[model samples]
Target: MSGTLVVGASHAGIQLATALREIGDREPVTVVGAESLAPYQRPPLSKAFLHGSADTASLAFRTPAFYAEREITVLTGERVVDVSPTGATTDRGRHLAFDRLALTVGARVRMLRVPGAGLAGVHHLRDVADATRLRRALTGATSVVVIGGGFIGLEVAAAARALGRPVTVVEAADRLIPRAVAPVVSEFYRQAHERRGTAVRLGAAVTAVTGERGRATGVLLADGGHLPADVVVVGIGIVPRTELAEQLGLSCDRGIVVDRCARTSAPGVVAAGDCTVVGADRLRFESVQHATAQARAGAAALLGREEPVTEVPWFWSDQHDLKLQIAGLSAGHDDIVVRGNPDSERFSVLYYRDGALLAIDAVNATADYLTVRKALATGATIPAEHARRADRRLKEMLVASLDA
Candidate 1:
């Protein structure tokens, strides 16, 4: 039997390899990662890991012995520089032949293209190495200026505040996390962060990162204002890593294009994780749940089975003591129903488009999150009027709706 080569030692890559074994595929499997460290969890890198509550040893997904027992070959510190129909060559000039290929190569952080951005105190947290450097910088940082208001930036800001360092979040948008959340949710986070002593700047643009002696000293604003900082964190966004897919003549639109089954343009190749854009809807998700589900589908496709990734996408973020859980995609929502009071620090925002439920954003409300996730998965939705009743449990309401 021919071997299967999976590029990228990411959450998707490792999960795909595991799924292959679970599904009774006994072919030779190899996973290649550019980083020297073993496959590790990434979600905590911005939160617990940066906060010093979690360490490097705790980040690994599986032990080396697990791979060895599975008879899976894992090559770390090797970068694939070339790819073709039959084989791949690493930067160290080692070539591996395979009949099936999986491209789980994830994304890279989008750096701030400004003066002094490459200075000593400017950092971007995308991987363990980035988080390690930022954690070290936070130790000596008196004040921090975060250049984006996205999840990573806000999480880092919260961590900095927890570390007793003053933080100022500069967002170019009118509110925080606008792309993924509604305006009300965005406004709530802005106030929540401000209440916790993190200064948030909305509709602010950073023109340049000013430095002194090759180290970031402050950020110069487009409005001619300057915020002093000993450390600068850039968390604008990420660009999907698709160069290898493009090299192999696969269809790429911002990311490697894949079907619901995680099958790429090539016949014997599949892809998963943040590196892929799926379906004609051009849907893309960077969450672990999506990556794992898509990888399972990719594994099934590799074995001549037709399994499609159709699970409702879910995501979560922890800021200070608040845990925000989201279910479904809220894009193109024409209306929203607010359940409970935001001041109580426990509420859910349900999104609807043309009287159909689209998504729900719940803060410190796990029941609501789970209820909506189940409802969406089963194609059931609660009425807007019924959802407005904060006193009633969403699960009860969902059951009532299903019965009706």
Candidate 2:
């Protein structure tokens, strides 16, 4: 039997291999990862792992014995430098032949290019190793300045604050997580972080990472103001790892272009995870849910089976005691119906586009999140008028809509 070579050894790569085996495809499967450690959960790296509440062993998705028993070959510490339709070559000078190729090469941390960015106290967290180094640095850090107000930056600030280190979050935009959440939701998080003692500076443009003697001392703003810090964390964004896809002549627009089935431009080559943009809309979800779902679809595509990607995208972030859960994509929404009161610290914001439900962002409101997620998945939606009534539960509203 021919083999399948999965590149990147990420969440998508491991899931694709496991999906193939579970679906009764016994062909040889090999997963190649650049990291020396086995495939592990990444989300916790910023929260639990960084705070010392979780360790490397606790972050693993599966044990090495599980892969061995399933006859799946996982090669760590090897990077696939070259690829083609039939095979791939690793940086270690090893060639692996396969009938099917899956690319799950995830994104890397977008580096800060300002002066002193490469100083001794500057760090970027994208993987476990980065988190480990940051965690160690946090031990002696008197103050931290996180350059960005996205999920990673906020989480890192929360962790640092929990460690008794004074923390400050500087966002280039007017609000936090503007690209992902609605304005109301963004404001809520801004206030939530501020209430937790983390200083938040919005509309702040970073000019450079100020340093003295090759060690970061703070961040210099474009306005000529400086924020003092012993440690500087850059959580601006990430760029997709699309070099291999482009090298293989696949269509790439910001990210590797793929169809609903995770099929790339070249036949026998499929891609998934943070490295791919799906459909004509070019929608790219960087969460674990998208990675695993798209990987399963890629697995089916490899076996010549039909498995259209049809899963509602959901994501969550834990900042201190705040649990923010988001369902569906809220971009292009014309109106928002806020359920409950934001001041209560437990509420949801529902996004609507021309009176049609598009998405929902719930904070410390898991039931509302699950209800909206189920409604979106099943093609059921509550009317805007009905959604405005905060007294009524979303589950009740959804059931009423379905009955009507």
Candidate 3:
């Protein structure tokens, strides 16, 4: 009965179990998760779910019948507290023995530890419960203060603004998504949010959350200023759930270290998703694309099959009506080439390093995004000036290069 066991039941873990079954190598597949609900889509929790545009049923990755039909056992409402050479121990004093294990215990939202942080009306959107609570709070909220200009904060601010609530975003960095995109792209997003009546506050640090009667009232800035807030959301970032991996003395540097094959240092044990730092570069990706791909590789490794090659990392965000899609890692990129006018609300920022394409940030430019996404995935490049041409289509140009 004991065979392949995956922890977390997240996008990565679910994909691993599915992949194993797809490959017809299923001995016995089981997924254990801390959440009572099955594995569900996470990105929508910040946008569609928070905005009341989506229901709980829409968030499900797969139905209960799918798991049953696949013969995959799902253990919900169970927390795997410890991992060892052979298996894991749950919080209920249940020790589950496994022949092979996959550790996909994703990350937790990193909370603000300042005063009044524990007050009511302050929320962090990480899962279904978090979004549900935040959505409920928005029903009575008049103003929202979003701490951190990251994707989650911005999306929540947009949702609040759509509901007629005034919103303000406080960012400690000089620009939005500072570590993920270029300054030009950041400025574009700032203008987009501001155009929608969202106050964009940059380079501002929050000293504390001021509360009234055990409920958050406003965020106190370090510069002696206060921003009124009936609802406060802290989206600073996340800390990888590496406790289980660390318990077994697996290599961990902020996250569990895994190779390209998704294999951990420990034998017969591997990791994927936000919980793992993979490849030689030790890149830790949080997007669904990275999670599923790595999980597939892990499943293949578990079955002694050739693993699929990893694709270029890609991520997308839907803020307001703009669809911002990014392909590849933009870190250390030297030059950026703009392909279309940002003033028109449609363009793509091509990231280059010594004339080689590294990444692209496209907003309202899905066609251009598809082209560049494929080019980046295949290690193809285009000349800076040629990419900037208004007469030539980006896909036409990139496809020609691929043909050559």
Candidate 4:
């Protein structure tokens, strides 16, 4: 009986445990997590979960009975205090020995160090408790001020608007979703949110949260501006939870470094999810798609499968009745071709560098998204003109229209 121990028991950790059990039920598997609750999907926390459209039951990844029946032992509310080459020690002071270990500790919300940040009405949604607090705060609050126009913030803003609260989003960057989406796609979301009665303040810096006796009343902007509000939701970004890895002398840069097989340099230790940097290149991802996909790959590797992961990375987000999907990786690119009318807000921007597809950002067009998704993964190159064609189907254009 080979002993496999997984730490963090987050999105990746749980998935890895399940995958291993499915591969060989006889393999002794143990999963540890800091959260008391079972693993659940996170993307919905800011949108459906917060808006009352969905609850915890709908977000749960799997029921408790599934783990019991699968023979996967899950230790919830147990935090790994230290991780070494062979195994880990929990805060309960138990030493868990293992032949293999996986780290799936996710991330935490980055907080502003400005004054009055500890104010009562300020919140950041990173977990269930955080969401619960934010939802409760909005009950008596008339207006909500969101600091940072990133995805997390925007989702919360959408939830707030859905609750009939006047929500104002303030972004330090010039455009919304500056880090994730292209400028064109960013503008589309901006327009979508704005049309829903959300006020957006761009290129604005927050100096501090104005408090009335440790309770948030408003915010002070860098430009001597102030916005009256009772609740302030900060969604700047996230910091990978890598302190445990750092302390254990594991290779960590931006995230835990893992090889193509998701194995850490430390013997008997593996890592996955938003906390890992995999594929020898150390590329980090914070999406559920990445977490689950990488977990499946890592579990197989831990079981000695060691299959090279050739799957193309994919991601999606639902907003305002629009489904936005992305395929392939977008680390560095030199050329981008806009394949449709930008003004109409329906297009796919194919990113190419050195005559190879790097990524595609499709807005409000599922067909375009699907086409580009296939093309990037299959390495099927088409004429730049055909990629930009409005009258022809992308599949037909792929071989015929590109011909000279």
Pairs with steric clashes in candidate 1: none
Of 1 and 3, which scores higher on TM-score? Answer: 1
Deviating ranges (above 4 Å) for candidate 2: 399-403
Q: Every model's Cα RMSD, please?
A: 1.3, 1.3, 1.5, 2.2
TM-score of 1: 0.98
lDDT of 2 by residue, 1-404 (tens): 26899998899999999999999889899999999998999999998998899999999889989999999999999999998778789999999999989999999889898888999999999988899999999999999999999999999999999999999999999999989988888899889888889999999999998888999999999989999998999999999999999888999998999999999998888999999998899988989999999999999999998798899999999999889998898999999999888888999999999877889999999999999999999989988888888678878887434346
Error of 3 at 324 (Å): 0.3
Could you tell me the lDDT of residue 51 within candidate 3? 83
* Candidate 4 residue-wise lDDT at 19: 84
- Model 4 off-target regions past 4 Å? 279-281, 340-345, 399-404
User: For candidate 4, lDDT tens digit of each residue in 1-404?
Assistant: 24888887688888888888778747689988888888777888887778778888788878889988988888888899987767688999988888877788988889988888899899999988898889888777888999999878887888888788999999999999887777877887888888889999999999999988889999899999999899999999888889888977889988888886777777667788888877567787778777877888788888778855566788877665556778877667767777777566677877776756677777777787788777766767556655667677666755422233
Answer with 2 or 3, whichever has the higher lDDT: 2
**Highest lDDT scorer:** 1
Candidate 4 yields a Cα-based lDDT of: 0.81
The CA lDDT of each predicted structure is 0.93, 0.92, 0.89, 0.81
**Candidate number with the higher lDDT (2 or 4):** 2
The TM-score ranking, best first, is 1, 2, 3, 4
Q: For model 1, how does the per-residue alpha-carbon lDDT over 1-404 read when each residue is reduced to its tens digit?
A: 26799999999999999999999999999999999999999999999999999999999999999999998889999999999989999999999999999999999999899878899999999999999999999998999999999999999999999999999999999999989999889999999999999999999999999988898899999999999998999999999999999899999998999999999999989999999999887788989999999999999999999999999999999999999999999999999999888888898999998877889999998989999999999988887778888678878777434346
Worst 10 residues of 3 by lDDT: 395-404
> Candidates ranked by lDDT, best first?
1, 2, 3, 4
In candidate 3, the residue pairs with backbone N, CA or C atoms under 3 Å apart (3 or more residues apart, or in different chains) clash, namely: none
TM match of model 4 to true structure: 0.93
